[model samples]
Target: MQTTISLEIQRYRPEQESEPVYQSYEVPLRKDWVILDALNYIKDNLDGSLSYRWSCRMGVCGSCGMMANGTPVLTCATFLETYAPGPIRVEPLINFPVIRDLIIDMSEFITKLKQMKPWIVREEEQPLSDGEYLQTPDQLTEYKQYSMCINCMLCYAACPIVGLEPGFLGPAAIALAQRYNFDNRDQGKKQRTEILKEDNGIYECTFVGECSIVCPKSVDPAGAIQRYKVAAAAEWWKSLLLPWGNR
Candidate 1:
């Protein structure tokens, strides 16, 4: 069995250099070690200056997402053995500004997520006596798939539209918008639809489908955008045909 593997990690220190560079480090090839483990090894034993973002070592936090061999993946979940016996290239997620060595600036993603209003939105809050909004199993299932997104942003890295059009709302955000739109308790679909109907919204996506492919949670953001498009078109036609009907 191979005793070690080489990792070509991208390094960027704004104070020292203007361009990003690859720095290679040899790490023990243990069966139980994931990419995050190798990175920790490098930071702890080899170089303390190496920087990255990670939390909850478990994959749930979604903070350890990065490009592993040019593919977006959760470093904590991708085992080093998968790319064994050779050099594996690791970089910060693309389509975002790198804040440091491996941490990309995620302010844009956060702003887009806020635009989607991921929480259940209601026009009027029911009185406390009315109790919490009740939802059946079927109602929950409507948006359950999209709710799985942990904001890993791997989908954005894999999306060509996002790379081509910075103004595009991106995959995860649109999917999350659908999550709220489909929620039985949410009444803000009209407002969200207006936002999504903009040029930078779902229409910008050519549906390359890589977003869904790279999603760690099977969020299927491409599908969500398509579904939204269909629904929006239907609503537009209905409004046009029946001016007397409530919008």
Candidate 2:
């Protein structure tokens, strides 16, 4: 017997709709199909109006993230059989404003990422003899786990605080910042901390930890936020004692 799957998608078309709404579709499914494949089926066969983002269907691109069956799962990684024998709910990742359908306005997330200066800052000029900055395996291990972030923003979507506060730096960006901060080769932690102390910096997170739970790449953004908080708190205390501490 052939199986038909029910897909309930959340639709938002900013050009025409005042609010987003859910639209359901019955799709013919193969047992091995992934959620993204089902979505493509809808787009290819049923509804051309459905909108979402996807690149590198293999899941490395991190563009296909969405809330599937109520949890934030990369659509490419979430197989249909997991939510099968029944209907499934597909919606845009939460916390950001929906641009249209499952494609949210990631501008907010991207802006914060750039604002964090998520890169290594060289403190000293490279010496001719020293060559490139060397990272020992242990040093690499210290932050290698965090560096796996694909910038999928699932952590941001899962974070309720980010949902409540649009200005918050959110998860993925903070994790990326933490990645550089923890790197032994990095020396700009102090300068970056200045910006981190702003209104939407580390203080914005209430530590609910939903970001870590929903992260698809296993990047522990909550832990990174906590570690950054420790550093920030120390810096704050140091500022109280020394006027130039944060400067």
Candidate 3:
């Protein structure tokens, strides 16, 4: 007998429905199939009207993030065999306005990302004649952990802080900022510090750690935020003690 599992997917179509609703579909339960495979089956065989985002089924693109059984996870990495002989609840990431089925408005996230200035900012560009800036392995190791972020937004969905304060900078963005902050070649820490010191910045986070728990790349955004807090505090003290010195 062929085995199958039920998937209860949340749907929201502005043209057809004013509110979101659950729609169930059955797909073969295969040992090697991830959740993306089942969703593909549904899109190809069962329903053509379904809408979702997915790329690089190998889990590098980070486009297929969704709420699976009440937890934010990458569908490309989640296997169906893990939840056999039953139904799985799949929904779009929470704490964001739904665009359609399994798609949410990421405009806010993108705006926050830009606010962080997650890039190398040198005061004066080294002339091409100077050649590319070089760094030792130890320097690379300083920010390597935070560099694994794929911008999947799973952290935002899992973060209670984001749910409470929509303006908060959130986790992944801060972590990526920290990545550049830790880079030896970068020189924009002071600029980023002022922005992150705002009322709705890292101070708003209550440290629930759900963002770190849901990160597929092990970026540990919670840890990054804490590190930034400590760094920001030290800078504050330095300004208090040495007001005459350049901050």
Worst 10 residues of 2 by lDDT: 238-247
Clashes of each: 0, 0, 0
Q: After aligning candidate 3 to the native by TM-score, how far in Å is the CA of 170 from where it should be?
A: 0.3
Q: Estimate each model's TM-score.
A: 0.98, 0.91, 0.98
lDDT for each residue of candidate 3 in 9-117, tens digit (9 for 90 to 100): 9999999999999999999999899999999999999999999999899878989999999999999999998887769999999998999999988999999999989
lDDT of 2 by residue, 147-189 (tens): 9999888887788888788888888888888888889988878
Q: Which stretches of candidate 1 lie over 4 Å from their true place?
A: none
In the predicted model 2, the residue pairs found to clash are none
lDDT of 1 by residue, 1-247 (tens): 6899999999999999999999999999999999999999999999999999999888799999999999999999999999988699999999999988999999999998898888888889999999989999999999999999999999999998999899899999999999999999999898889999888998898889999999989999999999999998888888899978986
What lDDT does candidate 1 reach at residue 212?
Answer: 95
lDDT of 3 at 153: 97
The C-alpha lDDT values of all candidates are 0.94, 0.86, 0.93
Best-to-worst order by lDDT is: 1, 3, 2
lDDT comparing candidate 3 with the true structure: 0.93
| Residue 78, candidate 2: alpha-carbon lDDT | 84
User: Which portions of model 3 show Cα errors greater than 4 Å?
Assistant: none
Which residue pairs in model 1 clash with each other?
A: none
